[model samples]
Target chain A: MHIYVTDHNGKEHELEALEGWRVMEVIRDWGLPIKAECGGACACATCHVFVDPDWQDKLHAASDEEEDMLDMVPDVEDNSRLSCQILMSEELDGLKVSLAPSAKPDAEVA
Target chain B: MSEQEIVTDVVIIGAGPVGLFAVFELGLLDIKCHLIDILDKPGGQCAELYPEKPIYDIPAFPEISGQELTDNLLKQAEPFGPTYHYNRMVNELEKQDKGDYLVKTDAGETFRCKVVVIAAGGGSFQPKRPPVPNIEDYENTSVFYAVRKMDDFRDHDIVIVGGGDSALDWTLNLAPLAKSLTLVHRRDSFRAHTDSVNKMRALVEEGKINFELGQIASLEGENGQISAVNIKNADGEKSLPATRLMPFFGLTMKLGPVANWGLNLHENLIEVDTEKFATSEEGIFAIGDINYYPGKLKLILSGFHEAALMAQAAKKIIHPDEKVVFQYTTSSTKLQKKLGVK
Candidate 1:
């Protein structure tokens, strides 16, 4: 399946991601700009990305923990989702996401 | 007597998997290093977040737990003899007149290094502060999440909170140092080591330290110096004299002091070039998740590769007179000898 990742700079990268692998894992395997710092533990908000609004309903809802972490992320939009929780499947092929502007500690983001 | 400033060829911040491997890479070139991390142990996120969690894709290791990987990295870096300074955060960085970097930590130690490797995975980890109004105002002076200097509390009235290892450990440690010491916890039970708990009970019985069964409700002090704290018990509210408050709540990750270092930041991560993994600042390289670049992959294997290239660049900065010769560990006898392989 081709998983499309729109980097922070708006460059689209078409990744041949395998099934059952997470969006974060596929993005990481392709060496995308996503940090995935906690390595899909959903602990760090580095993997937070904006799901294309058109495909937002196509993917499963974000987990409670992922939502909590997304809330911690700066510049969170209604389409925000943690890429780690987004598992890749054949049906979800062509899933597009734009990397969110990475968030720092709340005090330092300014 | 003036304290001798510790000097090294390179100072790598954050003793995670990448920093440990950097020690090995730099050690091959005879470059000495000293690594610093805020955590008490090495292996930043691996050992801290998911020690028992199994990690896949760690090249050559089909299946290995995070702790196992960290232990192996420690063993791998042992021959290099890189000094490890744990439980400290780098608070300041300054370019010295001699072109070396003058690095200072919260623990009051300084280092002069020709090259700086920032492997600080997700920046410094700090203890989660309890919810108290204006609690941030008392940090560093009267309230300390970490004990940087043991002597800082000498002859002072100290009150330790929480039921964890840190609280009990500090209670026993500071009892002899403080003019008066008191430990307060909501429950009678403790979550510390059995021996430390027994020692603390002994001290309580000996009248050396007071053990109050309650939670701190409010803090009272002025000018960042805490004088007293109100404790809420089952019976009533009581106040204790406390010149210093040591709360040992568990740690949480934050960008910490690294944000103020004046490095180019993509969000909280330092921007780096993939060629040398060097940050925007000259002679300062950032690898691992703490670094950001185009198509940056935050993985241990990626960090290892970055450490390799970073060491080569660092060697040039550390010893400009010597030429950097790239060699493979498989065929190079010099590399094998450095690895102590028979």
Candidate 2:
């Protein structure tokens, strides 16, 4: 399957994502600056991305952990989702998302 | 003034199992190594995640705890005398015109190395700071997350906040060095080791340290230097005279600036060839869980294998004329000499 990612520098990359990989895997494989610090654990929000409005309904529903992690991320919107939770599949082909701001240290709580 | 820039033959990016082994491997070939890790100490995920958990997979040991394994690795690499830069993250890696790389840290430290090894297991672990306004401004000054040098806090009025091991550990360590020490927490309970807690209580009884039950309300200082902290307790907000503040809340994992170094990544991991464990970038290699290969197992023993191969390849980069030879540590006099066992 194919997925499009717009990196932090506004450079777009079209990647061939394997069937079982997550959206984060595709972007990270392209070396596009997505931290994915926790490695798809849904614990860190470094992989937060804004799903293209057109493909919003195509992704699997965000789990409670993903929702909470996304909530912790700065500049989150209705389209905000952790790319790690969005697994790649045949139905989710051609997914497009723009990288969110780097999970800043300020976003962390005491 | 900036710290003196370091120059070495190899700069291992993580001081985990693979990185430590890389030091030993490279040292056998007469190459010096320097290691940088975001964590305050070595062991990476093993020490951070399950230090006490027993694992039966390591080669000779029938069973060993995570911390025990890390201790053994560090001991094994001690002969190499690898320089370890802890509590710092490598933020930049740029190739020099001479072909060596200049590695810069977020702390403004730099290293020039002929080979870079990424043994970063599962990414770098970052500290989770308390939510305070403009906290970054005070970082590395009066406010420190990790103590690199004990003498830096000698004779200073220090206030440590947290109920965990880091807070309790530093409290025990810095109590005598600090002129006036205070340990603050929301309640009297602590998640630290009982021995540390009892020792802390003893210090408080001996009038060496002040134990306060409260939470930090605000910080007071000027020009990134802290003088006092307003803590909220049952009596409401009260100002405590303090010169240095240490908040040991805990750590959070973040890959941090590694992705920006232009290395080829495969799912948040560096891609390396199996033969040399070399990344797409020349003179750079990745091992441990941070590197992906055709049949990588992400095991500590597997990383040890990668380290041996990586060191051989790194020798070519560090000294092209050096002839690489395979020698068994049990019988080879040269290998035993490097290990300092002969």
Root-mean-square deviation (CA) per prediction? 9.0, 9.1
Winner by TM-score: 1
- Model 1's alpha-carbon lDDT is 0.82
Candidate 2 at B342: error in angstroms? 4.7
Name the 10 consecutive residues with the lowest summed lDDT in model 1 chain A: A101-110
DockQ of 2: 0.12
**Global lDDT scores for all candidate models:** 0.82, 0.82
Error of 2 at B27 (Å): 3.5
* Tens-digit per-residue lDDT, B51-88, candidate 2: 66677889999999878988998998999899999988
* lDDT of each residue in A3-109, candidate 1, tens digit only: 88887667899999889999988887787767565768876566778888889999988765566455344344568888889988988899998876652123222
Each model's iRMS: 8.2, 7.1
lDDT tens digits, residues B94-114, model 1?
Answer: 997767899999899999889
Candidate 2: deviation at residue B276, Å? 2.3
